[model samples]
Target: MTSYDPQKIIDIHAHLHSDLPSDPALRVKALESLLVEQGLVDPAAIDAWIDLYAEEIGPKRGAHVVARAWTDPAFKAKLLADGTAAIREFDYQGHATGHLIAVENTDTVHNVVVCTLCSCYPFSLLGMSPGWYKAAEYRARVVREPRAVLKEFGVALGEEVEIRVWDSTSELRYLVVPQRPEGTDGLDAAALAALVTRNSMIGTDLLKARA
Candidate 1:
């Protein structure tokens, strides 16, 4: 139950090679070494923090929240009204989720999140931010051309649908509550949670009814 999948983290870090080094791993290693040398960061503390994220907080918590919202009207209302307080019920509050705001997607409206300034994200709930999310291109273009960006992610919306882009900051972050797929009325919370995907929660992919 790692906060994020290791392979995904690797994939995210893989795209970080630019002016530093061709190999991202080497670049990270060098940075860590320098930081350690300057006494700016402790290796053990960093390891502990990584382990905490990898072992405790993750997208599963977000899926659980989504599952409850799908089944409980009251909780869903509360979630949309005050996401920060609603998530505290599960003791899922942590790190970047302290100032969370939940936005729902409907037939006529879609929601997406971006951090135009940096890679700010609800990491405690959504796990680690994806590589593309940290890229300068995404940070710049998502706000200006969200529909086109979403379409590239395989989410095609009709012209009638309004797309809202939320910009996350260090003080506030956004979580998209994707529309629950139809044909899942009989599914329990656990079953429903199993169907939730990180991309859907990020508003990049639309969930389809279970077949």
Candidate 2:
């Protein structure tokens, strides 16, 4: 069996042309064909990965976890204390989430996650990793100039707010618990969940109170 290599996936994408088909489905199919044609990855490996993200899990799981933490102080305490165990409350304990750690965005601190070596993402929780997340530029730049990168993503933090970048590995992954948006005091968990964006959970985008 040919083992899947997340780093190789990045390398393969780096070699793909910028002018790939615009249609999302066709774009994925084109990439798959190119990788298979180049003998860089096996078709089954690609399909298995696609099925894992497309059918089994997504960012909604992470959003609900964040929403729960926002509402339940006890669960928030447990989550900050032991993320892997706390997420099991929602049956979000498997594979990429086995050794999860939750970091909070507070008044003085903000957290962002990156896999400097490869795209070692908690996809089972965060869904398919974004293309930029898997890019070499992001992996290298986010660690060195995090504040600048955050700004580029439209997340401008004051100098007083410390930005911490967490590196993910196969054995461990991170989840950013973004601060609850103001004016959401009456929102239920589901309503709050609907407000959570994947980028907000990734710390690239800040959550704003709905108007």
Candidate 3:
């Protein structure tokens, strides 16, 4: 198995330049430069890949699905019953999403997802996973101290509400359908989708009502 330097990874984020032997970000840049110099990788291609996920294919896909489920009762039922098939109705399918299951947030329950082993995620619908989601701290602490983690993310659930944490794997992925915000009764599907944030879909935050 390949081993990574934990210190380098920590240094990259901590920005402790004084204590570190070398700048982690600069080291990564130098490595990328070397790869480009040797024609082992293409910067443009990498940029294109990042752009495709960040803009073209992103949380908007999941938001559209959520909005559709919210507006259509039959679709919602289908989604709740078989998330994989329901999501396929929109033609959103790709890697790490072999068997999709959607957990819904309600008045009494909330759902969140994480990949303990690695960053196994539904990239097709959710786009790139946030850095925080893949962080070691988040992965280690979320399962054992969910309430505290949620509080750190500014989500304060009531004592009576149930918190469900879904551990995603390469074979089975999960999406959280956040509870619809109040005062959005007259909004159309597109409008409703606009209200859905990436964090809400990740269950780190809730949908806020439009002002």
What C-alpha lDDT do the candidate models reach, one value each? 0.89, 0.89, 0.88
Candidate 2's TM-score reads 0.77
RMSD of 3: 5.0
Candidate 2 lDDT (Cα, 0 to 1): 0.89
Q: What lDDT score goes with residue 27 in model 2?
A: 85
Record all residue pairs in model 2 with backbone atoms less than 3 Å apart, i.e. clashing.
none
RMSD to the true structure for each prediction, in A, is 8.7, 6.1, 5.0
Per-residue lDDT tens digits of candidate 3, residues 1-211?
A: 5349898777776875564449789877988999999999999999998888767888999999999999999999998888888988888887666688888899999998998999888888888889999999999988889999999999999999999998875588888999989999999999999999988888899888888
Q: What tens-digit string does per-residue lDDT give for candidate 1 at 1-211? A: 5657888878767776444786879888999999999999999999899998888878888999999999999999999988999999999888787788899999999999888987888888988888998999888998999988998899999999999988876688888999989898999999999889888888888987677
Using TM-score as the yardstick, the better of models 2 and 3 is 3
Best by TM-score: 1
lDDT, candidate 2, 169-196, per-residue tens: 5678899999999999999999999889
Lowest summed-lDDT stretch of 10 residues in model 3? Answer: 12-21
Residues forming the 10-long window of minimal summed lDDT in candidate 1: 11-20
What's the ranking of the predictions by TM-score, best on top? 1, 3, 2
lDDT of 2 at 38: 98
Error of 3 at 187 (Å): 0.4
- Candidate 3, residue 30: Cα displacement in angstroms equals 7.5
